[model samples]
Structure formats: structure tokens, C-alpha cells
Target: MYDESVVPVKMESFSGVAAKSPISQCIKTVLGRARVEKRLTIGLLPAIQYLSKNTNGALFCLTAAAPPGDSATHMQEVLLQAFCAENDIYVIKVDSEQKLKKLLGFSETRMDFSCILVHYPYTDPFSDSQEFDTSVLSEAENDLIEHCETNWDYAQMPVIKLPEK
Candidate 1:
């Protein structure tokens, strides 16, 4: 089981934004887009592997806060954070793994997922396989990027904390 002692980093603490802030909305939208486009990498090992091999996209990572005293989960969280930090990826921490799974449209009995990696590839005009127009997503991404630039300290790992339910 995941530990319960990990403290949540509140969004307001870093960005002064509430739970319903535009940043949160953008995140939801981006996640939806990534899901529809099949650009999301779920689970810790898959995410790590994807990040290790792919560098062609704008990457965003979302992780559930590790339960306190769950050394394995905590270690996974730390390792993921370090990898993201080294790669200049944005990492957002949500309240729990179940909530995150629900947000991703998984059924209640599905395997628990602690981490999700969303990859938004740089648009390729010449590719016929690009079915969806991503202009709206682009706008949301720009907003998120601007928010991060304005509010977060880039020197440290960019981990936006979502309020707990």
C-alpha cells in the first residue's frame, strides 16, 4: 500500500491559485487532450522509460502524493522528481492515486496508477496522422507555461501541489 505520511504541496502555497484556478482547468483540459490523443504514459516504470527514450515533446508529469511511511512509493516519488528536475519537466502532485485514476477515466477496480506522463508533441504540419487540431491545447499549454514561468522557481523541481480532497 502507498504510505500516508507524505505532505501535499498546496497550489496556493506556490502560485497563490485556488483549487478552481485557471491553471487547474488548463491541466484538466490538457490531460483530456492527451488521453484522446493517446499521448499519456501511465505508471512509474512506463513514464520513466518513455522519458528516457523520447525527447520530442512538451512533457508534463502528474503524480499522486506518496502515502506516509511507504518507503517504496516515497522512493519512486523521489526518483521521478529527480528525473523530472534533471529533464526540465513540469511535475504536478495531486491528492491521491485513486483521485488521479478517476480523473484519467479509469474504473474503480483498475490497477492503481501513481504517475501519469502527458506528452504534447511539437506539431508536425506534414503528418497526415495528426487528426486533431491542437490550437486550443496550444493556448492552454502556453497559459500553463506562462504561469509556471511567473510563479515557480525554475532552479528547483517544478512540482505544483493540488489541494487534498
Candidate 2:
């Protein structure tokens, strides 16, 4: 059982771009039961943060770009948690981007996480914002890593255009 964060670190996210959620959704759609120790968030804006609990979990990162902010960060986390509860997926939240990176690089291949969510992505790190829109990333497309030999009948979709009044 690979316990390490399994999620990737700084995989080329932009100041205005996002990746984590799209990848999470992809894995959720692709692996389903096999997907474990997941990490995800849906910031206050239309953006989201996501991290799968495996080395190959990031195969579905960043389908499109969304707005940014700590509120967005908080919202993302809430949405992710709700999603996991509904699906019975194990998830963790990291507040500091740096801490999040550390877990991703955790030497232990398998270990138990303190909390289902880590609010700090980093210990004494810098910023935790996006540089670009996640939509530009390749993982945004139809690329779900083969963790389990199964398929998800109904996987979540990246936020495309918002609703109109």
C-alpha cells in the first residue's frame, strides 16, 4: 500500500491556472475503489484543488483554469470533503502549499495521515496561489491513469462555463 502523499508537487501550475481538482476527478472517475488517501479542494471561486493518494494519481490534474484566493481555497476544500463523504473516498486537506509539497515528497511509500485533511501545504513556505488556468494542462483531457482495472460510470466534470441567468 503506497502511503506517501502519492500526489505530485509543483507540476507546473500557473498563477492563474489550477490542476489538483481536475486530476482528482479524473482519478475518481478512473480508479474509484482503488483510489485512496485522496486530497482535494474547491476554492471560493470557480477553481478547485485536488491531489490523489498515489504516485500516478495526478494523471487527471487541471482540466481548466479558474479564479483564485484563500476563500476559493476554503470553498474548494469544503466541496472536496462533501464529494468524498458522498463517495466514501479518503481525503486530506493541506493549507500550506509547501506542506502539501512535503507530503507529496514524503519518503515513506505508505503511511497513515494525521488528519483526513492538512490545512498547511507547507511549513514556513511562501505563496499558495496559481500562476495560470488549469485548462491548458494535458491532464485536462481524457487521460486517466490505470490504477484499477475498472471504470467510473459517472465521474465529476471540470467547471466549464458558469450558468447564465
Candidate 3:
């Protein structure tokens, strides 16, 4: 069973953590909800006893090979945030690439980007791919349209920048 305390946290709630741009606030809101909901879904103590560890599922992200503080990485994160804002997927800029890689089960030696997806998973038609179901995506789009008001232009949104180390 996953420890609730170990659940991934957003930058705002993480003590001593701060972000240099407004984009972090948006990222914090989305990731924070996901993290909290994930723990609540898993329940605690005896409730956890009935469910198998695997049934708890996993959080998926569409990460790139970007690292924070690098100019290229900053642009990559901003573009990523715009995309996520468009699709309603949560996005975050992680400074600790090594930490995220390790958490994603990769060896510590292998470093990778930390911008990841928090979308719900569904079965894909391809045997080798994990693409989202089209219907599901469409439904999500409709839901987003119904409930969310968004501005597609990145300038209109709170642009994300790298946090100071």
C-alpha cells in the first residue's frame, strides 16, 4: 500500500518551496487536487486491507526531457503549461529531475524531465500503446468546455518560469 504521506505534493504546500512564476500556482491547484483525491480514493487502515495494492492504479504524465533552470527547459515548460491548460490536464515544473526519475521507478543514474500528466487512464486500441480512448478524450473536452473558461493564448495565462534554486 502507498503511504499517504509520501503522496506527491504541489510546490505551494511543500514547506520551504517557492516558484518564480505565476504558472506554478495553476500547476499547484491541479496537482494538489489530484494528489489529495488519490489518497482519499485509497482510503486508510482497514479500508486499505480490502483492496489489492495494484488496484490503486497509477498517475501518468506526458513528460519531456526538460530540466528546470535551463532556457530551453523553461520554454518547454511554458509550452507544456499552455497545452495542459488547453486540454485541462494538470502540469508542473519539477526542479529535481533526479528525484522525479527515481520516483517514477527509473534508476537514479537516469535523469529525465519532470513535467508529467495527471489524466485518468483508459484502454487503448493498440496493443503496444497506451493512448487515451478518443471517446474519453472527447468527453473530457466537452466537460471542460461546459465547466471551464479558458484563454488559449499563453500570454493571457499565467506563464510559468523556472523556480530559483
**Best candidate (score: lDDT):** 1
lDDT of 2 by residue, 7-32 (tens): 33223233335444433444333222
Off by over 4 Å in 3: 1-69, 123-165
Candidate 3 clash figure, as a count: 3
In candidate 1 the C-alpha lDDT for residue 81 amounts to 76
Poorest 10 consecutive residues by lDDT, candidate 3? 39-48
Worst 10 residues of 1 by lDDT: 2-11
Model 1 lDDT per residue over 105-144, tens place: 7846666578888887547768876343445355556556
Pick the winner on lDDT between candidates 2 and 3.
3
- TM-score per candidate, chains pooled: 0.68, 0.24, 0.35
- Give the range of the ten consecutive residues with the poorest summed lDDT in model 2: 156-165
Question: Which model is ahead, 1 or 3, in terms of TM-score?
Answer: 1
Q: Give the distance in Å from residue 154's predicted Cα in candidate 3 to where it truly belongs.
A: 15
Give the winner by TM-score: 2 or 3.
Answer: 3
Each model's lDDT comes to 0.64, 0.32, 0.37
> Could you tell me the TM-score of candidate 3?
0.35
- Candidate 2 deviant stretches above 4 angstroms: 1-69, 105-165
